[model samples]
Target: MANQGPKSQTILVVGGGIAGVTAAIEAAETGYDVILLERGPALGGRVAQLNRYFPKLCHPTCGLEINFQRIRKLKNLRVVTMASVAGVKGEKGDYTVSVSVSPRYVNANCTACGACAEATDMEVDSPFNYGLSKTKAAYLPHEHAFPMRYVVAPSAIGTPEADKIKAACKYDAVDLEDKGEDFEVNCGAVIWATGWEPYDPEKLESYNYNLSADIVSNVQMERLANHDGPTGGKIVRPSNGEPVKKVAMIQCAGSRDLNHLPYCSRICCLGSLKHAVYVREQYEDAQVDIYYIDLRAHDKLEAFYQRVAADPQVNFVKSKPASIRIDEEGRPVLCGENTITRELYEAPYDLVVLATGMKPAASEGYVPDIAMEQDEYGFLVPSVEGDGGIIPAGVASGPLDVSMSVQSATAAALKAIQAVGPKS
Candidate 1:
């Protein structure tokens, strides 16, 4: 694929998250042929699973749907779901990407009818809910999946459940015999919009994440507050299903410590603050305690900090928690030294939430072998002069919130467009 020849005008984006979606749409609408590949069964990525965004507190569906519509209208853009880039060969404008695709087990003829779901009794952990609940073996990723198609877990491939699911489909969209395949796509430039994942809370040995049923991560807190979530939008204790009236929000959990990430995630402070709002808005008498080294609510976000602080029920404490212990009363007791008062505090609450940081998607399994430059925090940042043909966008470049990610994606689109040049 590399003859040192003039490169093709095709641009390939190897992620279908917000960043990938924005970059693809911008480049394609600007008149370049673009291909978007998602490793998951559907598009929308982490944004699809969010209850509401910070700052504005708006549902993520509206923004995602608008992007989906824009993509549908652009004939230059082609979306391929359940596909990932396995390898890359050549350099700059001349590159060949090896793409491996997984089977969805459901075909385009699918009307998204509920027949297959009704036929399956087998269930698996729902990744959409951060594994807080289980889902049918044959189920849609979520109500607002971009392609609106269903997927079958690999465990059901040769089981009787597979045959039952296929038989129940009236449109014959279920294809139990569909085998995954690997293919190649040649493109001039590649945009790495692969986003980040929540840092694993289990690694924070001091927090006791698994020891207490009510101690959860910030991402899980989003699900618990979601109407479609397992608890049906009520912030309740998973242990006894009791309403949560008093809560502790621990900021910088597993972040800014040499033992862990060692740098500020940049999003945790705002995310934890948003969690506090969700709790306050739900219950009139609910009390929220926020523990943090400092509130990094910079610029426009500082106003929001003041707005939340005005609430009498929400109290801010300056401290990095030393440890969490489930007392004899079954409450999570937080132990720490308050830097402000120079006092050691031991407080207990109905629920404990650890605001974990973001770990780059590239740092994880997604394109783990990509030869891109990363910052000290494992973000794929482009140099001032820029990488030749591979552009990094969104959290893939660095830790950023949704709005900042969109702006980064737009910048990446501009770079990719410049690399590929105009239609000849």
Candidate 2:
């Protein structure tokens, strides 16, 4: 029999979000060959899309830039974008994983010049903006994209628009013929850091997200407040470009509900609090009302909650809104029972942000076919005591905010190192 130990010490980290990036960087900096794969066109992940983080409210780009610098300095690490694992085979330290790479239709020779984007009139719903804006057929994923590369939408292929884009790239980086291809990566340890997606608010049915333009989800609120966002960092009404002075933040919109996620998302509370901060920072006279079954700020976050609560402009209401209705004047009216006061109330706001919970990326489909084990909630577990060389990092392990995800990613990187450590 072949010697049953790690075939190679190479570590493959799937998902190039904050967690995956941290795992890969940590392992590689520690003298390990690491492969970091991102299923998107860039590596910043959801955090990149945010205006700022909670607690300090620092711009996400600050952290991302530091991480990017670390990544650039690591010689043993290779970053791959637009790639996902279709399957994972073999055992700990001897794994062969199939990778499916989607076509970016842009080649490595390209400099991130705006000529291609300027040449195309065809526009697509900007996923980076969470459908709040549109972008040219050939566009950059975001300004802070790690590779700082451009992507050509599939719709632009096989047309005059494609030719225009190709001709526009003076360096000849546009590859219209670039169809996605599949390949394999051989590694000893695998870290799954697939992140989370926001729960759909429309399912609430009572929230009336579809009926009103002002009822925005918390993530979209992030975009709306971002300087690079569709509204150019202004917290304004979507229906009309009027400044927002009154806002309601609904917490646990889909979390801790037996009918919905059934667990505390752990981030929405802090996120909504941050949203309130954003509003207060933008409008000094803005009145912000936060509705929650119970406040979830724990440990260090308690201070943040306290500080925000101290703001007289910010009101913390103890209730789960029964439903939101649009008045004839296009105002979002929140109707709910105030559990604390035992009263029914209806309030109107120019903008209402829903703090929806997070749903795991692996919740439904496309988990790697390996010894990976999933919990009742679909978050990936160590296949077997993590000895099987499959370790789950960040939100892939459970619901975690940014800071916790980094710590979790570091722990998973250490575990991965041990899994491929010196042989017995």
Best of the candidates, lDDT: 2
Kindly report which residue stretches of model 2 are placed more than 4 angstroms away from their true locations once superposed.
1-6
Model 2 accuracy (lDDT, Cα): 0.90
Write the residue-wise lDDT of candidate 2 on 1-424 in tens digits: 1222348788899999999999999998998889999999999898999999999999989999999999999888999999999988888879888999999999898789889999989999999888888999999999878899999999889989999999999998999989899997888899999998889998899999999889999999999999999999999998898999899999999999988889899999999999999999999899999999999998999999999999999998999999999998999999999998999999999999999988999986578656678888878886654456888899988999999999999999999999888642
lDDT per residue, candidate 1, 257-299, as tens digits?
8998888889888888899999999899999999999999989
TM-score of every model versus the real structure: 0.96, 0.97
Q: Give the count of colliding residue pairs in each prediction.
A: 0, 1
Worst 10-residue stretch by lDDT in candidate 1?
A: 1-10
Worst 10 residues of 2 by lDDT: 1-10
| lDDT, residue 256, candidate 2 | 95
